[model samples]
Target: MTDYRAAVQDMNFLLHDVFQVSQDWATMPELAEMMDADTARAILDEAAKLTETLIAPNARQADEQGISFKDGEVTTPDGYKEQFAQLAQGGWVGVTANPEFGGMGLPKTLSAQYEEMMCAADISFSLYSGLTAGAIMTLDLHASQELKETYLPRMAAGEWTGTMCLTEPHCGTDLGILRTKAEPQADGSFALTGTKIFITGGEHDLVDNIVHLVLAKLPDAPAGTKGISLFLVPKFLVNEDGSLGERNPVVAGSVEHKMGIHASATCVLNFDGAKGWLVGEPNRGLAAMFTMMNYERLGVGIQGLGAAARSYGTALEYALDRRQGRGAKATQEPQAEADPLIVHGDIRRMLLTMKAFVEGGRAFSTYVGQQLDRAKYAATEQDRADAEALVQLLTPVAKAFMTDTGLEATIAGQQILGGHGYVREWGQEQWVRDCRIAQIYEGTNGIQALDLLGRKVAGSRGELLKPLLREMTEFLQADAGQWSAEYQQLADAVKSLTEVTEAVLAQVPSDENIINSVAVEYLNLVGYVVYGYLWLRIARVAEAQDALGEFASSKVKTAKFYFAKLLPRIHSLRPSIEAGSKELFSHELNEF
Candidate 1:
C-alpha cells in the first residue's frame, strides 16, 4: 500500500495562525464555551493517527477486493466494518454535530481539516461519515423537533449511517422530472415507491441501519420540483423507542462497479412502498435537500483538496527518494551515480504545481469553512446574513475549482511517478479516478458553473457579489510587504471579475445562454482570484514567522511560482467570457 500521513503541521498553521479560529470560537456562543485551539488541535492529532494507521491500509486492499452484491445485501470489504466501528467510537463521525446530540460541536473550520485528512488517508471509507453528517445537518436544520429527538442522537453516534437519495434513472440535476411517489397513509407516514440511482452508502454492513433521505413527489402535489417532498426512510424500521423493528422495503438493486472508491457502496436503491416519515413538509423537498447538498458540496471540495494533498505527498516522497536524473546545479550527493528526481526542472515544476494547488486549495477551503461556521453560528442576524451570502456566492467555486485542480494535481503526480503512478500498487492512478467523481457528482462542474454565473451572480444582479467583494478588498488591504506584486494581481483579477460579472448580468435578460457560454470561465476566474488571495495570506503569515526557516522560505517561493505560472491563466479566461454566446449558439447540432 502507498504510504499516507496527515498534514497536521500545515493544518494547525492554518487553524491557529492563518485563520486564527480561536478568535472566532471565542466570539461565537455556539462554540466559545466548549472549543479552543488546544482542544481542536488535540482532535486533529488523534484524527491523524486513526486516519494514517487504520483507515488508509484498507484503501488499496478494498479496491482489489471490491464490493459484492448477494441477493439484496451489499457487503463492504474486509476491515471496513471494524475500522468504521473504530471511527464511530473515536467520535470523528460527529466532530461538528451538536454536543447535545453527542457531537463535539466544534466549528466547521476544524472539522473541515479532519475531513481533508480522512480523504487523504482513504476517501472510500470516509464517505460513510461524510454523507451521514450531511444528513444530520439537514435534520438539524429542517426536520421537526420530534424527528430530531428520534434520530439525531443515534445518527450522531454513528449507530445508524445515512444516505441521500435524489437522482432517478430519468433525472439527475433536473429533479422536476422525478417519478418517485410518496403516498400519504392514515398513520401520518408515507409509502414511497421509486428507483433512485447513484446513492452513496445506500447499503452497507458497517452500520446497524442506514437512514435514507429520499426526495419523492406526493400525490395531489403541484407538478415539477415544487411537488417534491423529503422523507426519512430507514433501511430498517425504527420503533418508537428507537430500536430496530423490521426491515423497511428498501433494497439495494445492485452496487455500481465504478472507476474508483471501490469500497464505498454506491448502490442503485429501490424503494417499494417503503415506510418513511416526512422531513420538512410536503412539496418542499427540493429546498430541504439543498440544505444537505450545500453542506455536501463543501465536503466534495475537501475531497478534491484531500486528493491533491495526498498525491503531492506521494510525489514529493518519490521525487526525493527516486534517483534517476542528474542535477542542474551541484549535486548534494557528489559521490552518487545520479541525483534524485528533484534535480530536474520539469519534475520540480510538477511538484510545485501540486504544492501550489494543494496549499492554495487548503487555504481557500478553510476560508469557506469559516464562512459556513459564521453563517450557522454567528451571534447576530446581520453577521449570519453576511456570512450566508458569502457562502452562497462561493459554494459553486469551492465545488468546481477544488475538484478540477484536484484532478489536475493527481495527473501531475502520476506524471512525476512515470509508469509507477498508473499501476495499482503505487496508488496515484486511484487518486485520479476518485477525484474525477467530485467534478461530476453533486451537480456536475457544468451545472456548478451555471449555478455560479447564473443563479448566484446573475440571478441576484450583483447583490450577492458584494459580500465577497467587500471581504476580498479587506484581505487585500490588510496585506504587509511580503507579497505586494501578487496583492496587486489579486486586486486586478477581482476588478476584472467585477467588470465581467456586471457585463454578463446586464446581458443576461437579452441572452439566456450567455451564462452557459461563459460560466465555466467565469467560475474559473473567481476561483483563480480566490486562490491568489489565499496564497497571499499564507505568504504574509510565513514572512512574519521567518524564523521557521526553510518551511517559510518554501511557502514564499511557491507563492511566487503561483503568481508567475497559475494566476496568469485568468487573463486567458477573460477573452473567452467576453466572447459571449453568439458564436456558441450559431453552431447547429451537426456543424462539426
Candidate 2:
C-alpha cells in the first residue's frame, strides 16, 4: 500500500495554495464559519486513514472474489460490509450533503478532495457511497418536500444507499428512444414499469434500504426527452411516520459480471408496477436527472484521476526497488549487479509524466469544485452566472480529459512495471481494468467530446469560451516575466485552438456531421492545451516561492516536457476538425 498521508498533503497544496478554496468558502456566509482549513484538513486525515487502512487492503481480494449472486441475493466480498458500517458510522457518505437531511454540510470543494482519496484507495468500495452522494444531490434539488423529509435524512445518514436508474436495455445515451412507462394511479403515486441496466450499487447488503431515482415516461407525456419524468422508488417504502413499510415492486433481476470493479454490483433492475412518487413535476424528469448525471460525470472523471494516482504510486515504488540498467551518470557503484530502475531516463520520463498529470488533475478538480461552490453560494448574481458558465464549460473537460489522461498514465505506470504489470498479483493490471470504465461510463469520452465542441464552443457562438479564455490569458500574463517561454507556448496553443474552434463552428452550422466527425480529436486538442496551461501555472507558483527541491524542480521540468512534447498535439487536431463531415457521413449502411 502507498502512503496516503502524502496524498493528503498534495491535496492540501492544491486546495489552499493553488486554488485557495478556503478563501472562496469563507466568502459565503452560510459556509464561511462552518468550514475552515483546519476542519477540512482533519476530515481529510481521517478519510485517508480509513481508506488506506481499511478499504484499500481489500481491493485486490474483492476483485478476485467478485460479487456472488445466489437466488436474487447479491453478496459482496467479506469485510466490505463491516468496512461499510465503519464508513457510515464515520459520516463519510454525507460529507457534502445538505444539513437539513442530517448531513454534515461540508463544501463540495473539500468533499471532492476526500472523494478522490477514497477512490484512489479503493474505487470498487467507493462506488457504494459515491452513488448515494450523487443521488442525494439530485433529490435535494428536485425531490418533493415530503420525499426529501422522508428519504434524504436516512440516505444521508447512510442507513440507506442510492442508485440512479437511467440507462435501459434499449437506450444508454439516446433517452428519446426509451420505452419505460409510469402510469398515474387513483392515489398520488404512479406505477413504474421498466427495465434499467448497468445500475451501480443497485442491490447490496451494505445498507438497510436502497433508493432509486428512476427516469420514466408518463402515458400522456410528449415524445423524446421532453416526456421523461423522475421518480423516487425505494426498496422499502416509507410509511407516514417515516418507518420502513412494505417492499416496492422494484427488484434486481440479475447482477453483471464486468471487466473490472467487480465488488461494486451492477444490476439489471426490473420494475413491475413499482409504486413510485414523482420527484419533480411531470414531463420534467430529464431535467431533474441532469442534476445527478452532471454530478456523477465529474465524479467519474475523478475516479480516473484516483486510479491513475494509485497506479503511479505503486509503479514508482516498484521502480525504486526493482534492479535494472545502470544510471545515465554512472558512479563507482557500477561494480554492483545492477542499478534501480529509477536511474534510467525513460523510467524518469514515465514517472514525471504521471506526476505532472496527477498534480495537474488535482488542481483542475479543485478548480472545478471551487466553481461549483461559487455557483451555489456566491453572493452576487453575476458571480453566480460566471461560476455556472465555467462549470458548464469545464464539466465535460473534467470528465473526458481527466479520464483520458488517467488511462494513459495508468498504462504508462503498467509499462514501467514491465512483465510484472501483466500478472494479477502485482495489481497493476487491476488498475488498468478499473480505470477503463471511467472512459465508457458517465457518457463515453466520445460523447463528452461532442458535448464540448457542440454545446460549449459552437452552441452559443463561443460565449462560454470568452470567460475561460480570459481566465487562462490573465493567469499567463500575470507571470509572463518569469516563465515567459512556457507561458507563451501555452498562449499560442490556446490561440490556435480558439481559432480552430471558430473555424469549425463557422462550418458546423451548415454541416451537423462535422461535430461527430471531429469531436474526439477536438477534445484531445483542448485537453492538452488546458493541461499545458495548468503546468505553466504550477511552474510559476514553484518559481515564485524559490522552491528548488525535488518537488519544485520536477514541476519545472514537467512543464518543459509538457510544452515541448504535449502541446504540439494540438496542431494535429486542427485539420481533423476542419475536414468537414463528408467522409464519416459518406459511409454506406451495407459497407459494414
Candidate 3:
C-alpha cells in the first residue's frame, strides 16, 4: 500500500485560484482579521506534515488491532493515545472553534482542507476530534453562557470529547418516534433515560470525559418531532469549579464490531437516569441538534472525499509502478517484458474515473465551505440568507452524492489492483469497506435523497433550489471562450435539472408517493449537474492560470474527463426521475 499523501497542492489551487477565498474573506471583517493568504497556506503545510508523519502510519496497525473493550472502559489501538494527545496539544481539535473559547477560530474553507487531509491520513483517528468539533459548534450556537463556558473550552482544548446520540435501536431516520425520556428536576436540570445505538466516540479513552448531545422527550411536550428536545449528558459529571465529579449513568453497553474503521468505536449507549442539562428550549431540540447535524453532514461528505482521495493516490501509485500488459499501440519500454498498468485503456479509465470524482468532489466540498463562511460572516443579511439557502439546497447532495461516488471511486481503485485489492496486504479492500459506511451512516444515502427531493425541494416549493439554479445559470451566462463546449454541456445539464425538478414538483400533487420513489434518481441528477458546474469552474480557473504547471494542466484535463464521460450520468437519472411512482408502486413487497 502507498503511504497517504495530503493533496496539499490541489488544496492550495482550490483555495487560491479556484475559490480565491482570501478575496471573499476580505469582504467579511471577522474573516478578514482571522488570517491572511500566507497564513492559510502555512497552516495547510503544517497540517500536511502532521497528518503524514503522525496519523497515517498508525491507520493500518489500528485497523488490524481494532479497539479493546473490557468491563466498561474502551481502549483504542497502540499509538492512538499518544497521537491523539499530540493532536490535542497542537490545538487541532478546535481548528475551527471559537478563538474566544480556546479555539483557533478559523474559517470553514481553510479548516475544510485540514479536515480532508486528516480523513485521508486516518478517518478513524479523525472522528474523535471531528465529533468534538461538531459538539463545540452546537454549544457555541445554542448552549447557555454557563454551559458554553463550562463545556466548549474543555472540548475545544481536547480535555474532553463529545458525541451525538440520536439513533435508537428501532429508530434511525424517524426521530419523532424515539422513546427516550427527559424528566425535569427541581434543580433545573433533566434526567435522561434511554438507549442510543450507533454512537461514535461514545466510550473512547482518548479524552477525560464524553459529552453526549442527546435527543429526548419532555413530559408535557407535544407528540412527534415537535416534542423532541436536546440535552447534554456527560459520562462523568463536572463540579462548579470545573473539576471532574461523580460518574453519570451514561455507559456504553457494548461496542459494535464493524466491517471497517475498526479503530473507531461504535457504541450502544445506555442512559439510565443520567443527569443532564437542556441545550436549547423545550420542544426545539431538533432545531438545535440540526446545527450539529448540518455541520456533520458536510463533514461526512468530506469523509467520503477523504477516502476517495486516499484510494486514488494509492491506485495511481500502483498504476504507475505495477507492470501488467503491453500498451495498445506499442511497448513504451522496449526492453521490458510488459508495461505498467497505466498503459492499458481499462486501467486508465478506472484511474481517471477515480481522479475525476475525487477532484470534483474536493472542489464541491470547498465551495460548500465557502458558502458556510458566507452564511456566518457575510456583511449583509441578504448575502448571509443567500448563502444559507445554497447550503440548505446542497447539504444533502454533498452528503449523499459524494458518498455514492466515493464508494464508486474506492471500488474502481480496488479493481485496478485486481486480486491484490481483495487481500488485506494491499489495503485497497479496507478503503472500499470504510468508504461504504459513509453512504450508510449520518443518514443513509436513501434518506439523504428523500431529504433533498422531499423536504428541501418539494417541501420548500422549490424556493431553496432557485438560488443554486440562478447561480449556475449566471455562471453559464458569463464568457467561456475556448471552454464554450464544456460550458454549453453544463448549461444543458443545468437546464435538464431545472426541467426535471419542475416535472417532479408538478407530479407531486397527483402522485403523493412520487418523491419517495424517484428521490434517489432526482438527487443523483442534481449531483451530476452541480458537479458539472463545478468542473466548468475548475477548468476555467486552471486554464486562466499564468503558468499552467503540471497541477493546473492536470486540473484542466480532469475537468475535461469529467465532462466528456461522467457528467452525462445525468441523462440516465433524468428519465428515472421523470418516470414517477407508478412502476415502483406496481410491485408488491412479497413478490420477490
What would the TM-scores of all predictions be?
A: 0.98, 0.97, 0.99
- Distance from true location, Cα of 481 in model 1, Å: 1.8
lDDT of 1 by residue, 539-569 (tens): 8888788677888888889999999999999
| Candidate 1: C-alpha RMSD after superposition | 1.4
Best by lDDT: 3
- Tens-place lDDT digits, model 2, residues 1-592: 3443338877876677667788888889879888888988888888888888888888888889989987767899999999989998988888878988889888778888888888888889999999999999999998888889899999898989999999999899998878889999999999999899999998988887999999999999898999999999999988899888998888889999889998889999999999999998899988888888777888998999998899999989999888886786663146678888888889988988888778888878887888888998998999989999988888888999999999889999899999999888778888889999999998999999988888888887888888888888888767387567877787888788888878888887588688888888888887787788777877777666554477667677777887776677777778877787898878787854
Alpha-carbon local distance difference test for all models: 0.89, 0.86, 0.91
Name the candidate, 1 or 2, with the larger lDDT value: 1
CA-only RMSD, every prediction: 1.4, 1.7, 1.0
lDDT sort, best first: 3, 1, 2
- Model 1, stretches more than 4 Å misplaced? 329-334, 478-482
Off by over 4 Å in 2: 1-6, 329-332, 546-549, 586-592
Clashing pairs in 2: none
Q: Candidate 1 at residue 218, lDDT?
A: 90
Q: What range of 10 consecutive residues in model 3 has the weakest lDDT sum?
A: 325-334
Q: Would you give me the overall lDDT of model 2?
A: 0.86
Lowest summed-lDDT stretch of 10 residues in model 1?
325-334
